[model samples]
Structure formats: structure tokens, C-alpha cells
Target: MRMLAVVALLNLVLVASEAITLEPCALALELTFWRMSGYLGYTLADWLCIVHHVSDFSIQPPLSKTAEKAYGIFGFSNKYWCSDGVQPSRNYCNISCEKFLDDDIQDDVLCARRVLTRNEGAQTWPQWAEKCRGKDLSSYLKDCKL
Candidate 1:
């Protein structure tokens, strides 16, 4: 009877720990992707202003380099979470990273280049975030806004 109780308690603790770690990291990853994408957009905005000689006071950019560096500094601020042991998030992260490297970054960089070349200004982060919420980033990068 004592052995049975111990086993049950261990199982419960294991299950609880498992639950806590999984969902939050997945949520965090989605948030990170959008935030990164938004920063990229914002950086292009700043570059555009500089090239067009817009007044520094009126111009604002996303600070993409800073954001990338921050990914190095903090955790979600620095670390990218990857879950293993037959978890969906782990598989998803690998696949997502590959896709981002192969496709999304290229497309975004091209878009950023175009936006920077135009004299017209780019949207502020709030506006960009709103637009990003609906757009999908393949499978892993989900917009949690709605």
C-alpha cells in the first residue's frame, strides 16, 4: 500500500511538471516570432527615414538589431525554447526554424528593402502587430492576439 501511494505521488508530480513546462514555452515561441518579425519591420522603417532625410524627431523604427541582440541577452529575451522527448513543440521548433531560415527571412528582408527604398513611412509597431496577428507564419509561429 505504501509503495502504491509513493508511485501515485511521483506520477502526479511528474504530470504537473510536464504540464507546466510545455504550453508556456510554446506560447512564448509564438510571441517571440511575431515580436522578431515586427522588429524587423520597424528597423526597415528607421532605415527608410534615414535614407529619405525625414526629421529624426518624427521618425521611429523597430530596432531590429537590438531585438536580435536581446534574444542573446535575456531568455525569451535571450533563449529560444526547444522541447524534446516526443513533444510537438520540439518537432515544431525544428521545422519552424528551418522554414524561417529558408523562406520567411528572405521574404521579409526583401520587403524590408522595398519599404526602405520608398519615401513613404512605415507603420508603427502597434499597427504592424495588428497586421501580423492575422497572417500565419507557417505552423509554429502562431499569433496569439485574437
Candidate 2:
């Protein structure tokens, strides 16, 4: 019994150490790109060219994280809270465990889940930032001609 307890405690410490070193998620990629562009003196024309994949500077969306980089596959930081509730640590949340339909954004209350899962795609930044008027994505989504 003593030997088994020691092994279990060792395994627990290993797991905790591994979890703390996970990388920040890809949602931060756009901010990094813009910063690099600014440093390199890139212009609006350069951005257009890059977005359309017409140049070597074109951005590729990063792949989901692998298990070696995180506790799970698709290494997105699962430590996010919805518009409704708090997530305790990572991958665990206090949100209701309710199920709903895919075509369900019309209702205001139902929009919480969509907000939780929606991608910060290039297409929606305009509308999303508009609605998120007082929210904190402001500087990272700073005004830039593109």
C-alpha cells in the first residue's frame, strides 16, 4: 500500500507540472501578425497581398494543438468563461449543461453558447468588435487598414 501511494503521488505531480506549461492559443495569432507587419514597414497593399496568398508573407492559420503541447489534442486554451458563467480552471466550466439546436442564435439567451464557441474569424471582426463595444479585445484588434 505504501509503494502504491508513492507512485500515485508522483504521477499527480507530473500531471500538474505538465499542465502549467501549455502554450497560449491561436486566437492570439492575428495580434502577432499585425505586430510583425508594423515592425517590417508593411503597408495596406502588403496586407491585401498577403491575405490573398499572393506573397511569401501570407498568413496560415495555425493547426489545432497536439497532445504533446497540451493536456489534450487541439491545444486551444480551454480555460475560458462564457458570457454567462465562470470556468473553474481549464476544460471545466460552470455553464449549464444544456443541449440546443445549431440554428439557434436568434434568441438572446441562446446566443451565449454561440459566443462561447464562435471563432474570431477575419470575416466577423467588424461586427463582433462593434457589438463588443466595451469589451477588452480592443487594443489587440486595433484599428489597421486591411
Candidate 3:
């Protein structure tokens, strides 16, 4: 019974720490994702759009066995949860569900682009999160309004 109480206390402490830790890191890390997502051929909005839809990090840009093996750590379930799950406030959903697990990088990027620009301008990750879906993808990148 004492051990159970200790475990519960530790869990609360760890959970609380994560919230505090993310306050500083979340903006930088997510902003970087927006900046870098373009390198993968995803528009800033494109990446945010797909990240909005994934149910799990394991499924985002779901890599095939060949690609999964190549990405080693990324292949591990929950590894990219920062971008996929851990960051509940941000939806860096760049890769489309259709291509999230796909092995073809180029194809995935194209699919992602389509998803992002499919609507007007380009909705940002924050927009998607606020609206809870893809909608306001503006032409250029937007820093968080906050």
C-alpha cells in the first residue's frame, strides 16, 4: 500500500514537471517543426494540417518496414509524440494520414501539400488546433497570435 502511494505521487510529480517544461520548449520546438516541415516539401500549413488528424505518432507519416527500419528511433511508437501526441496544444500534422505511414518521401510531401493548400490561404497548426481541424491555411507562415 505504501509503494502504491509512492508510485502515484511520483507520477503526479512527473506529469506536473512536463507541463512546466513544455511552456518554454513548446514554442521553439513547434516553430522549428513549422520551419523545417517545408524542407520535407511540406508547406508550413501542410505539416500542421496532417498533424491535426493523426491518432498516434506511430501512425504519422507511417513508414513502411523499409523506411521504418531506416528511421530507427522515429519508428519506435510514441517517439515523436512531442509533435504527434505529447503536445496537445499544437498540431504539427504535416504528413497526411494517407501518406503519414507511406515510404515515398516525395509522394508524402505532395500529399501533405495538397492537404494544406486544399482550403483557402493556409491554416496554421495553432489555427487547426483552435478550430480543431484544417480550415485557415494562409499563404505565408504565421507566428502564434499569443
Instruction: Give the number of the best model, judged by lDDT.
Output: 3
Per-residue lDDT tens digits for candidate 3, residues 48-143, read 443433321223333444312211112222232113333232223343233334333443334334434643323433434454344565532355
lDDT order of candidates, top first: 3, 1, 2
Q: 1-146 in candidate 2: lDDT tens per residue? A: 99999999999978544321111222124324434333334332322332222112212222236321111111122243221123333323333222111112122122222333464422222433343334443343344433
Across 1-146, the per-residue lDDT of candidate 1 in tens digits comes to: 99999999999978544311123234334334545334534432332222223212121221345422111001111122222222234221222222222212333333333433442334422333343334443333233332
- lDDT minimum window of 10 residues, candidate 1: 69-78
Ranked by TM-score from best down, the candidates are: 3, 2, 1
Best by TM-score: 3
Candidates 2 and 3 compared by lDDT, better number: 3
TM-score of candidate 1 against the unseen true structure: 0.20
TM-scores for all candidates: the values are 0.20, 0.20, 0.28
Compared with the true structure, all predictions reach lDDT values of: 0.31, 0.30, 0.37
Candidate 2 — which residues are off by over 4 angstroms? Answer: 20-80, 83-113, 116-146
Colliding pairs, model 1: 42-62, 71-78, 74-78, 75-78, 75-79
Judging by TM-score, tell me the better candidate of 1 and 3: 3
